[model samples]
Target: MHFEQANRATGRLVTTGEVGASGASDSELTTGRFDGQDGHGGEDGHGGKGGQGGQGGQDGRGDQPWFELWNVQQGLWLQHQLGESRADSNLPLWQHLHETLDLAAFRKAVSFLVDRHQALRLSFQDTADGPRQRVLPVHDLDVPLVDLTGLADPEAEVDRLIRIESATPFDDLGSPPVRVKIYRLASDHHCVFVNVHHIIADGTSMGILLRELLLCHRAFAAGEEPPLAPLPKTFEAFVQDRQQWLSGTQSKSMETYWLDQLAAPLPRLRIGDYEAPADDVVNETLEFWVEADITEGLGALAKELHVTLHILLLSAFVVALRDISSDDDIVVCVPFFGRDTKDLDGMVGNFVNPLSVRMKMSGSDAFDDVVRRARSASIGSYANSRYPFTRLLEQVDAEARPGRNPVFSSAFQFTRFLPPAKQTSQLDLCLYGRPDGERIKLRFNYNSRRLAESEIREVQSCFQAVLRRILGDAAISLDSLSEPLRQARRTMRAAPRDGRRLGRLRGSRSTTPDA
Candidate 1:
């Protein structure tokens, strides 16, 4: 409930501006005025001030030797190389504000931020002992403003620009891996786009950065200094803390837990009909909003069952996947937020860590049974949240084949995450759920190499149908759900791969058409 979000009159990338795109669907991209706090954030959500003089993050360049990267960081870094070379792991965030211009204030606020967070000035290098990272001194910030109000189609131009910017890679060595551009559609209307590499930030970092930017802009607009509190801890300090934690006993315990959880030959995801691509496949996204009725019932069920909404949704996802695969063992990769302590609450870095959650299913299992299994798996993973998935992969003796993941290929998360930008992923499928008031917004991204468009449509149809039934009555048997999924799979197997919509893959279940 205390999640950080953008204030009213704010929107992210390509969500249809006020100019000439009135006919566009809101579901094309994530656009809404998320509620938030004043002047950065507080202890309740975004990190608050506690440690004083932790300037190590802001001006700690060349002060000491380079530090080791977090296990996940190293994994992402290597993933960029070992595979068909990812274009760039960039996360784009944007906001639309209808207000008068104050360019001076905006620039100052950004400069103040550059001087405050060390991540804004990070540089990586391949050292003798592998890759190491260090914070560099504050450099020039790329805050450019473009006036598009004179264009015939300002909104359409904005959309095109977003796609181009999302595909562009960052120069991590020459300057900071961030670009802030202001698109002016009118005198009182503007769109702020900020693109940062995932190495330095995650979904949570967007909220923190936006809060700081707004707080600084407000203060400077009123002809006053920014009143943002000093960060309790710097990103560098958090990295150092993790270094020591990795060598401690708690870290060892988490490793043992993971080692036991994923023992022996791991299961590979085989839902898609096409063969896994030799290289990174062309990724595509299918986003839709769950029905208001289903959303209401799911919340009620969660409350009745004494579990969080995340557990409920994740349970439904597990059941849907299980029905399609008809496999007894289910492994879904779920990433957990890594802001474990207050010291890390405000720091902006790659703090999202992944957990390879495995669930065992039986034919006689009911909806409630799967919920309990999901709850247990979730709680256990949360307890051992520090264990890195990359480390687990190294310890697990799974086949190292290209294309499909040797371990779990499907991933699921119930968090405010970045929209699909690169259109490429190491995994075959990913489901992201973000809570929006009474309804839940879902984004399903799939690899074309592993799954055809029609096949993924079947997967989505199956999930919604099974979810509606589960919410209606938890006592329904899982054995009853497989017939629909199995039939859909058969239909997909027989359908031509000429790229046509597989409308109504399931027998009478309503499916949200491609957005």
Candidate 2:
């Protein structure tokens, strides 16, 4: 049987095979089908240079005016006024490399990435008709390099610089929404930070960009041409195709499914001391990790029950929220990687769609039963997730809630992405992931004005405790859990008007959390 494995040292596909029943030869095994080609490759296993020039029409080089804002982009534009700070929509990725990087090659790589992906050079403008995306021509991008080697404490200076870059919002109207900064800590050690507006890039896009940047940098340092494949489709082409699909029968069917699924009014969970705070509420993040053993156990349970780890964990989250808030109906917004086609696999853009997964628990269902139900609900949502979330809100005519998301305030996401392996020989990259003995890293981002830090930590502890209990016995009832968990539920259920149930609520309670 033929199989493929990625050569971590060189980010290339290598084909190998096990002895098959037919006794295929070694040569045959090594010459098996290679699925990495973009279909625009020549017969000699090299990519064709057909679309290198200005290929008019759908190639995104035609005389088309400003591109229409994608459904999600339009929604973000409409709600831009509601954000507390520009950083609210900023997505920053920082990397610590153990070796010195070639500054010139790194800058060229960044420019190469910008030239390859049109989305990185996108700018938004408001016209007489509506907001549109302007695809700017590719040009040289100067990656800002800060030499902090002479600072008293270079590491602290790097931290300060990261905070500044993260907090500074991109001017989407005036310039490209992506920024790259490199901080040199020593002759060989460096820190790289890349920040992009969430409207233009998603988690997957960051990975794509990093992989290409490393590839280009390595090639440049070696005085060789970059071995990057041509993208089968551009983000602009994706936008056009998506619009066409949204006008098709399949989109109509998806819309119908979403409409029925979201017909009922969403139930809000009041777990914290206060109600949902306004859009301007300050947000904070609490980070924790689930041990490898518990994570392994959860995976075993999920596999045994024929459910995904996401559903299993989501079920636990719902149970915990129910115990804390006494809410039977729960809705948690989950973001899915929106690249559904092979053509879009290597493309970069805001290809993330958040779907509100609602679960109605009786506060008495068994853990296994909840997992099963959640699996079913999640599968249904995934099927229709191609529909724009903004369109769903408009179709359902969801009412605006001042301080919370239109339908749900709380959000849950299981980001199972593995960062691309570093290919540059010069840099020893340290990518973000669970530590040596950890299984899952949990980041809790919540509005500090609505939920106290203590309350958030308590919620994390309770979630961990509940997850352990469920893994121990999937048949256990939610109400039959330990007293602390049960008491948490009761406290949230009967929260007093003074906002002291979870803790002392301190912000203006008129607004709600962002969706």
| Winning candidate number (lDDT) | 1
Q: Which ten residues in a row have the lowest lDDT in candidate 1?
A: 8-17
Q: TM-scores across all candidates? A: 0.80, 0.77
lDDT (10s digit) by residue, model 2, range 243-331: 77777787898789878877767565565644444544654666778888988898788778876666677888877766555567777
- Model 1 Cα shift for residue 151 (angstroms): 3.9
Q: Rate the local accuracy (lDDT) of all candidates.
A: 0.65, 0.62
Q: Count clashes in each candidate, considering only residues at least 3 apart in sequence or on different chains.
A: 2, 10
* CA RMSD of all predictions: 9.9, 10.3
Model 1 spans with C-alpha error above 4 angstroms: 1-57, 60-64, 79-88, 149-153, 172-174, 416-418, 421-423, 435-439, 484-515
Top candidate, metric TM-score = 1
